[model samples]
Target: MNNFVKTTVLGGLIFLTPIVLVVAIVGKGFSLVHGLAKPALQVLSVETVLGAATIHIVSVVLLVLLCFLAGLYSRTAGAGRLGNWLEKRLLEKIPTYPLLKAKLRSALQPEQLETLQPIMVRFDDSWQFALLVEQVKPDASLVFLPGAPDAWSGSVCIVSGDRVEPLDVSVQRIIQLMKRLGEGAAPDLSQLRFGAHEA
Candidate 1:
């Protein structure tokens, strides 16, 4: 009974920690942006013209525009260096920032998401779902075997190239399927090329 209780509590904590952290970060960011937009709202007298509700919408628009501008700037060579320097000197000092940034990047960036390819890795008679990291040699490939229900946590394995079968699915789709505990994997796995190889 004691072991069960302890295990359950730890599981709950692991599940809730990411959610709580994301919520806290989002709330803080919105508050900061809203504060910055307040002075502009006062100068424009938007409250007098459109009422209080529109001010919140305007703040959200400003926040989105700010993000767009930052994205553009970050793409530039000079801005990229500056951003890296700021991350190294300031942002990295905050423990959660690096993890949060990586998660956000993988979620938002198409190029980054493309690097983690969904695949099936052979293990004796059975094949396992995995993400292909890269080919270390002509015949050996490095892959990540993600834990079910928690796609981010996983182990890396080096297996023969022939043992890896690329799946025709998006990284996000695979992650969602994993989070659903393999409930809706049939449609995705239906396209497997194993039969062709066997013949």
Candidate 2:
């Protein structure tokens, strides 16, 4: 397919996915409130005392209160630890939980979290964009060279810090550029005057 079409679809999916996810979550929450409040609404004969609106209003109020209480409880000392324990024991075993949690976290974090540093790597005759995982010493860094299209598979190398010219770009942008296979995504490296291995 053409790049324009591919980019348009990709952009649409990115915009719509979170919206769909939020709507789904709210829909389920609404259903839960309806089922849970039906008996209470009927028992008190609230529909007659107030009106048909009473049932729906009561259900929504109860749902909000229930959510507030749950959030309040999760922050307390004992409940916090208990929740963590339960998550590790039960939620962690669910195959997609960790991946979903990580994606959610990355989305929620600030735009520049600075967990990784993008670097233009030059070693001998090879040059590529890579992430500086860590710098154990002043002149050495653990770098990861991510594969194009799917960056999850990559090789790690211990490269001299001198040969890795750090880029003043966000790691997320670096990943996106690599995923696009350098299609108008390469970072500016003209300012890199030193620490290049003449690639």
Clashing pairs in model 1, backbone N/Cα/C closer than 3 A: none
lDDT of 1 by residue, 1-199 (tens): 9999998797677666667888887678778888888888788766555577776887788777887998898889999899899999998886556545656776787578788889999787677889998889999999988766767656788998878888999888877887898888898888786545452
Candidate 1 residue spans exceeding 4 A from truth? 1-12, 39-50, 85-103, 124-126, 166-170, 186-199
Top TM-score hit: 1
Best by lDDT: 1
Q: What are the per-model C-alpha RMSD values against the true structure? A: 4.4, 6.3
User: What does candidate 2's lDDT look like per residue over 9-118, in tens digits?
Assistant: 97566545555766787779878898878887688765556667776787788778987998899779999899899998997885445544545655766453477788
Off by more than 4 A, model 2 = 1-30, 44-69, 120-133, 136-163, 175-182, 187-195
lDDT to native, each model: 0.79, 0.73
